[model samples]
Target: MSWDLSFMFDDLLPALLVGLQYTVLSTVLGYLIALLLGLLIAVVRRVRVVGPVAHGIMEFIRTTPLLIQLVFVFTLVPPTVTPLTVGVVVLGVHYAAYTAEVYRSGIEGVAKGQWEAARALSLPLRRTWGAIVLPQAIRKVIPALGNYLIAMFKDTPLLFAIGVTEMLMMAQRVGQPAGRVMEAYTLVGIMFLLVSIPSAILIRRLERRYAAV
Candidate 1:
């Protein structure tokens, strides 16, 4: 049978938009959690006492599949917690391991002179990182972080595995009753392309901008 382009746009789009809302919400909130947690992991790993343990944990997280982590969290967490919340936390913590590596590279990329200069001034450790190291490191890593956000956006469909009713899940629900799976899934692919392509272009621009620094 021929594709129903009209139904794809008129009926399917709206429903998918609702799902997109959840997708966007999860990505944004989850990315924030990842950014912060990754920074924390990177910073903590610099410490003399707990560094090895933190390194081991980060390695473990990075080595595992995010799908496994998501399923594990969904099964292990109390039902009182919403599936969305579980999805967000799992996505965040999983990506945080990678982001931690991003952060570690960024932090390490800072010139040794900067750290020595901080010491030369007798600057407090907090001030050294807060004022000097992090600013430079974060600026350098913006492109990488944006790329991860885009990756997370595409990965939102995995939320379906946990019954989160995200975009792909919404598409399936809308299509199943009407037996319009082609229209539904086609639109979903279009939607993803629409968002991801522009985002990828923006990230490239960011990479150029940051690389110039």
Candidate 2:
């Protein structure tokens, strides 16, 4: 049949809006986790303070498939817990692997002279990282981190697989009664563009700003 979005606007809009709310919330929480965990991993790698163990952990995460990680987090955990929280946490942890690499590049982008200067000043490791290293690293990585955030936003639809009822799932549910799967799915696509396009633009602006710094 022809694509008619009236059903989506009339009936599914409310539910879709709710789904978007959950999507935004999940993205935010996951982003915070990605940022902190990524920065920590990057710092550990940069200092080489943790030696082989840190390298091993980073390599393991990098090498492994994130979908497998998602499955483990979803099915291996206690079933009593809410899937929404678990989904967000799973997304966070899975993407943190990618974020760790982004952070490492940012950290490495810092000039060697900066590290030498910090060392010569007798700066403590913590102070050097906190005051000198991380500032530059984070500034450099904001665009990359923003990319991860956008990726995480897109992945929120995957939460539907775990029964989180995100946008794609909502569209599927709504389409069943109307037999308008094409319209519903197309609407979902447009909605994603609505959100993701602006996000991408903002990320580009942020990249320009970071580059200027």
Candidate 3:
């Protein structure tokens, strides 16, 4: 059967955009949560008093599949909390495990001499991290973090399993009446590529920019 490209663009696109808005919102909010929490996890994991416990927790999160975590939250949380909110939190906390590793690597990559120099100057621990180490470490991990952001965007579709009307769910909704599954699915694929490709290119550029520093 011939594809009706016009129907896909004119009818399907708008419906998908509604879902896309939620997808974008989840990605942004979730990535913000992941970025901050991951850094905190990495930092806390370095502390002598709590390092082992933090390490164990991080490993548990890292080992578990994110889909399971999302389902668990959706099942166990109070119904008062919306599925979208639960999705955002699960996505963020799930990705935080991976980002934590990125952060740990970046923090470790900082030259030992820099830490020594900070100590030599009698810098307070907070000042040393804030003024010296973290600035460099965060810069080094920006590209990796961007990659996770894109990954999180793709993962937003999985919210469908939890009854969220994200892009793919909307695509299915759009297709059902028309019996144009191909058109609907194809459009969804194109939309994902449109955003993810440029994002990946930008991340590569960031990688180069930071590497030069």
Better of 1 and 2 by TM-score: 1
Clashing residue pairs in candidate 3 are none
State the C-alpha lDDT per candidate.
0.93, 0.82, 0.92
lDDT of 1 by residue, 147-170 (tens): 999999999899999999899999
What tens-digit string does per-residue lDDT give for candidate 2 at 83-173?
7888878777777878888888878888999999999999998899889988888898889888888889988887887888888888888
Question: Roughly what TM-score does model 3 have, to 2 decimal places?
Answer: 0.96
What does the lDDT read for residue 199 in candidate 3? 97
Candidate 1, residue 108: Cα displacement in angstroms equals 0.7
**For model 2, which pairs clash?**
none
Could you list the CA RMSD of all candidates, in the order they appear?
1.0, 1.9, 1.1
Q: Residue 72 of model 3: what lDDT?
A: 88
Which whole-number lDDT from 0 to 100 does residue 81 have in model 1?
A: 89
Order the candidates by TM-score, highest first. Answer: 1, 3, 2
Clashes of each: 0, 0, 0
Query: Which residues of candidate 1, in runs, are more than 4 Å off?
Result: none
After superposition, which runs of candidate 2 have C-alpha atoms over 4 Å from their true positions? 47-51
lDDT of 1 at 116: 99
Candidates ranked by lDDT: 1, 3, 2
TM-score of 1: 0.97
